[model samples]
Target: MDKEKVEQLKIQMQQWLNEAEEFINHIPPVQLYTAVGVVLFTLILLLIIRLFKRTTSNTIILTGLSGSGKTYLFYQLRDGSAHQGTVTSMEPNEDSFILHSEKDKKGKLKLVHIVDVPGHSRLRPKLDEFLPQAAGVVFVVDSVEFLPNFRPASEYLYEILTKASVVKKKVPVLLLCNKVDKVTAHTAEFIRKQLEKEIDKLRTSRTAVSDADISNEYTLGVPGEPFAFSQCHNSIIIAEASGLTGEISQLEKFIRENVKP
Candidate 1:
């Protein structure tokens, strides 16, 4: 009886296979090819979109004038402690890792690729090499010594804000005022107003020069009005941090916002 049932089941399976083959054979060559092409095209398009999203940059650039404490901030973010006596870096300090603050979390987190570009006049050109891949730029400032370095700091920031890569891509910038734990540190609001004033002055003088003579790919601010961070195409945020005391929550927040977990 078992053998007889097995034979019937085999015949039923063979009949289904034959019917399926006949149905396929009845399909016109054009219709079959079109259906296959549609499926293949859809798969290729989905694959391309996935690749594009995965390629989205995870780089965060820390840049500012010499003595602005960018290196300290970089180390603090990666190591969670200020490694003492860190002098001005001659070369770019770069690393890809999960932020030290996030390491204690339970689940897997995305690694942030951070580049601390040296702020010396000659090394400033190196910033162009990494700006293309930057998810966000943190322009560090020495809040305790801001007044003395205000002009130069603003000039450097002006150059960065005008770059074609920064402007065209609308890469967000965080005007990070570092070393705010000190007694005489300036407020982030004060530093922001001062920077806006200085950048406005720069815009005036720079716009007078012929476009060919200017290295900046795009002019900053509106032609007739005063320049403000709010007027730029890219978003500019001002925040405070103390790399020395490891009070970098704002900086970490900015990084996480730009480079998601």
Candidate 2:
């Protein structure tokens, strides 16, 4: 071919390449915006899932009479064994939230934040503050002592239930009949029945009002009902300060099932 023809061919090829580059640069802004939007949307989705997990977790507050095993359960939950003695009140500097995480039988994660409040009658006044913070209440009862200590336990239960009801929230209650291994006749089923009877009696007494008795009346706060009542199915009770392994696991499972997350 001639040099002039070759030069013309080169010029036509250069012009074609320049036009292609300009056309590429003029591509729609919508496509570029869509690419950026996808990246931002992915980031937002991840953040929402993380926030949902944190928000849906439940917090439980354990309350019962002194020597009712609230502290024992707390220690068992923390260490996976009830080997430690009842945890005494912490110093002013210590944090109040005792958070523990354990895996369920199916390998699902279970998080529990147990607020251990003082069980003595004197500390009853402080329950108002604690009860409202908890999503559920684990009311530990000493099964062996129930016969001798029934009056005080019943009164305490009434008070707690009333206080809980006044807030217009029906929190689930787990009646942990602790120390069941000590008694020969007191099976978990038996304890459950007795407690249910006692609860019914309490409810009846509160609601029973004669026509003439309307002069003076009293009302309960919790509506004379329990949120969730169950017996501790484990046989090894009397969770000593050394450790309460068998019973604690049962209690943990019960909580995970009934307590909403």
Per-residue lDDT for 86 in model 2? 53
Q: In candidate 2, what residue range of length 10 has the lowest lDDT sum?
A: 232-241
Candidate 2 local lDDT, 1-261, one digit each (tens): 999999999999999999998976787889868878999999999999997764454666767788777776776666655554455443111122322434333444545666777777777666676555555677777776667766677767756655523224555566677776673425556655565566557756655657455333234423535522332111112222112434565566555654443
Instruction: List the global CA lDDT of all models.
Output: 0.93, 0.59
lDDT of 1 by residue, 1-261 (tens): 699999999999999999999999999999999999999999999999998875578999999999999989988999998894279999999999999999989887999999999999999999999998989999999999999999999999999999998998899999999999999999999999999999999988887888687765788888889999999999999999999999999999999999989
Q: What is the lDDT of candidate 1?
A: 0.93
Name the runs in model 2 displaced over 4 angstroms: 1-57, 86-110, 164-167, 183-185, 197-245, 258-261
Quote each prediction's TM-score. 0.84, 0.56
Mark the 10 consecutive residues where model 1 has the least summed lDDT. 207-216
Leading candidate by lDDT: 1
Please tell me which predicted candidate would have the highest TM-score against the true structure.
Answer: 1
